[model samples]
Target chain A: MTQPRWLDQTEMAAWRAFLTTSHLLERRIEEQLKATAGLTHPQYEILVRLAAAPGRRLRMTELAEGVVASKSALTYQVGRLEEAGLVERTTCPDDDRGVLAVLTPAGAELLEKVAPGHLEIVREYLIDRLSREELRAMTSAMRKTEAALRSG
Target chain B: MTQPRWLDQTEMAAWRAFLTTSHLLERRIEEQLKATAGLTHPQYEILVRLAAAPGRRLRMTELAEGVVASKSALTYQVGRLEEAGLVERTTCPDDDRGVLAVLTPAGAELLEKVAPGHLEIVREYLIDRLSREELRAMTSAMRKTEAALRSG
Candidate 1:
């Protein structure tokens, strides 16, 4: 077999920084959400997505895709949210077998309360630390990365 | 409380791209590792870290930190690795209560075999897609983000 190509200095540096920052950012967000609102990161994402959707609801599959959660994982989180009266599942109007996740008023209120803290964490650790040009460059790079992964 | 500052368009774009790209990158890496090596991402991380450590061993707590896993989660992954004969646990020579995770020959061999395909995924999706300037910008931004999160 041919020899595998190894990462060069620049690639290695970028990859290591991305990996460390991603883990740290996720942990920081989870800590803030759990401490202030008693919600996990995935649960918080579900609420945010649902709150932004048209009519404040999304089909279950769409919600799963939006939150980058597997169907089973989404179901479990949705169940917990349902139990807490934060979200409710309803039969799709157009498709009997389809389900929709609808955010409740309680969920919206909680999101409004929790969102400021969430934004603070995001800004303090990520957005505010970078220059506008740096942010633009990183965003363009990640967008390309996302497109490639999706297509591949 | 005063109204919490919200993300502007530029910040929002960067945040969303980062979130989506991080998820996609992780999922792609996990899928590649699972298919080629029958290893989960965290398990692979453990082996890699162990292989790079002095004498191919690390204390459990140090291993956990290096891999960004919780102690219990690291314990569980290490248990599985040990069962597979790829890793072994031994008491620390200096500290009786301390446990060290040592990489077996099989573990290093597996990592060498799996690493090529893993690097391919990272390069194809992330590193190769960005320009040199973009890579530098992202690395700088992420390094700052990592520092802030680590301190905060």
Candidate 2:
């Protein structure tokens, strides 16, 4: 058996803090989004990504990557969103076999309507809670973490 | 429609950082736990909570609250764990109507086996990636965020 590498005081504290912050923020945001717009956070992210794209459309593979979801999960989610008249998938011109997820006008409208409440919840749980210095430090720390995770 | 209250550049940057960091870390941790120990992070958390409780047991309601799961979800999860022989649910002696989730020896053993890998991923993606000052700032920031979430 390998040694049980336990966390020291500071590391344990930081890990606990990270866990609580992430879960609480996600729960609060998801609850409000579901209550108000009937959208999950991942759905919200998908719409946001498409809305930000050059033509308000992205290839399925790109959409899946942007949302951190598998292609099949993205397909199911996009299908639901489409059934709700929020988004539509079309064949990509650039790749004959590739599909594109396009934000419908209805989806754009819904997103615009939902953005305020989403940002408000974000503010209550995060933006308004932290000092500017803390925010800066957190952003920097996360960037480093992302880099480390990507490389190793 | 209320005003959009769009985020300023710094706030936007911090928010994006938080989103990416939280999602990537969660995905990485969950993937590793699932692959190595056949345990979801929530299941691991449940085991940990039970392991720490007196007699390695806790009421179902308390378990739900501690793990941020709904009662129904907790019931289903406990049922699955019980089926797997890692945990058992029994009527609480103090309250016949309430059920207790007890960590069986197998569950405790599984948690012990999983903890080191979990902590290693946590270190790689979080603790070891940030400076001490950054970790301290993040801890304080998360505490404030949690307090704000609880109050509202």
DockQ of each candidate's interface versus the true one?
Answer: 0.88, 0.74
Model 1 lDDT at residue A132: 90
What interface RMSD does every candidate have?
A: 0.7, 1.3
lDDT of 2 by residue, B41-136 (tens): 888888988998999999999888777778898888888899889999888898889998999988988888889999988987889878989999
Runs off by more than 4 Å, candidate 1:
none
Query: Which structure among the candidates has the greatest DockQ?
Result: 1
Please tell me which predicted candidate would have the highest TM-score against the true structure. 1
Error of 1 at A4 (Å): 1.1
Query: Candidate 2's interface RMSD, please?
Result: 1.3
**lDDT for residue A104 in candidate 2, whole number 0-100:** 98
Note the chain A TM-score of all models in turn.
0.97, 0.93
Candidate 1, position B73, lDDT = 96
For model 1, residues A5-67, the per-residue Cα lDDT tens digits are 899988988997898789889998999999999999999999999999999999999999888
For model 2, the superposed segments whose C-alpha errors exceed 4 Å read none
Question: Candidate 2 overall Cα lDDT vs. reference?
Answer: 0.88
